[model samples]
Target: MISVLFAILTALSNGAASVLQRRAALAVPDTQTMRLSLIGHLLRQKVWLAGIGLVIVAAVCQAVALATGPISVVQPIFVIELPATLLLAGFVMRVRVPRGVWYGVAAVTVGLALGMASAAPGGGSTSVHGAVWVPALIVTGIFEAALITGAMSTRGNPRAALLGLAAACGYSLTAALMKDAMGRLDDGGVTALMTSWQLYATAAAGVGALFLLQNALQAGTLVAVQPMLTLGDALISILYGVTLFGEELRTGWWLLPELVALFLIALGCIELARSPLASGHAAPPRRSTRVT
Candidate 1:
């Protein structure tokens, strides 16, 4: 029960962070220019920086939640952020969200919930040393290089999707490294934070990833980019938790349900891609005139 509560809280925090980030992204109108200069403009925006700070806090909370809960339990709950972010955009931020996205949100939420409910619990805990973390970092670097190239080559939504996928992978691996560090922490919390270079590296990577994600969001629709970003992050994190952290299915009986849940998640992503919330300044209407 404690694990369930913490998982929900983590999901909520993540949802709020995504909403704020989206708002900040939408606030920046699209201007065709060199990518490096655009990034500089984004970095200078203090409101957006605050949104990034919120996401950082969410990531930290997620690390703490994973430290205490089974991966199966934690991963599914993270999916809640998808719906929460969309709803926040439509209702709180007063952005126009299409019906297709609402359907996608439904599919993702239900599928992830079913998957979590049916997933097998971890068999046992496992730990790894900091020295073994280098390869993961390299993989992340390669992934970012590929994503930036793709984003530069593609146009419109495709570029955003590619960038979001890259960000998702980076965020996933960073979380995995963070979990590894958490498992190895010493008694003194502050000392543990100071001594672990892996944690600091993971944090830096996450920040870089977020910068990419923000650029993607600014360049594409919320519906197309946000769901893809959230779904990819959830799936990758679960995969890492199981394969890297040694988490497992709760029972043999759960395999089918988990598969079904994943199917639902895929359907959800497709739905979200059909249409997304519009971003950019609303244009002024023409003045009324009498016929002559």
Candidate 2:
């Protein structure tokens, strides 16, 4: 129950952070996309700094949740971040959320409850061998590189979705590494955490994810990016939980409920994407400066 509460807090923090950061990122010149100069510009924005602070808090909450509960359980709860983002955006943008949007949020909440209750994920290994980490990181890195390359070659919604997926991979890997690092901390204290490569790996992955996410936001509308980002993270996190950590979710008859949950989540995402709050945040691209 404590882990569940932490997971909810993580979702809230992450959702709020996304809106704040994206607002700041969109305010920057579009020419700064995928460039280090973008960070420099964002640093000038207080909203972006606040967003970074929330991200750090979210990371801490996520780590505690992963330490106390199975990844499958903790990760799924993060789907709430979508609705949370919409709600936060409504307040920040001063837009009214429609009745339909509220219905979607209710569906998502109820679906998650049903899914978590039915799936009842079980714990597995807290630590993994170096061999496991090596192959997993290699494969995920290759896939993320492919996604980024594809995104760079495109424009608009497609590019945003591809970059969002790449970011999702990075975020998922970061979560896994964070969990491993926390496990090491438990076993060997601060010294273990300092010595573990997982800690460094988590930080690297987190930076990469942030870069990709900022670019994704710059490339297109939240409607195009947010669902892919949320869904991809959840899917990859599930894979990490089951394959790397050896966690288990109920199968057989429970598969039906899982499918229903997925449907509800998808529907909710679609509805949220159509909300006035999300549309209002879809800023127009800044005019480029041309030099003779």
Best by the lDDT measure: 2
Best by TM-score: 2
TM-score versus the correct structure, for each prediction = 0.71, 0.82
Per-residue alpha-carbon lDDT of candidate 2 for residues 73-168, written as tens digits (9 for 90 to 100): 888899898889888877775666788789879888887888787888878888775589888878897898899899989999999999988888
Our tally of clashes for model 1 stands at 3
**Please, what are the lDDT tens digits per residue for candidate 1 over residues 202-289?**
7787787788888888777665576667667777777767666667766577788888987888788666545444333323345699
Lowest summed lDDT window (length 10), candidate 2: 277-286
Worst 10 residues of 1 by lDDT: 276-285
Which regions in candidate 1 have their CA more than 4 angstroms from the true location?
17-60, 93-102, 121-127, 150-153, 186-188, 218-224, 250-256, 270-292
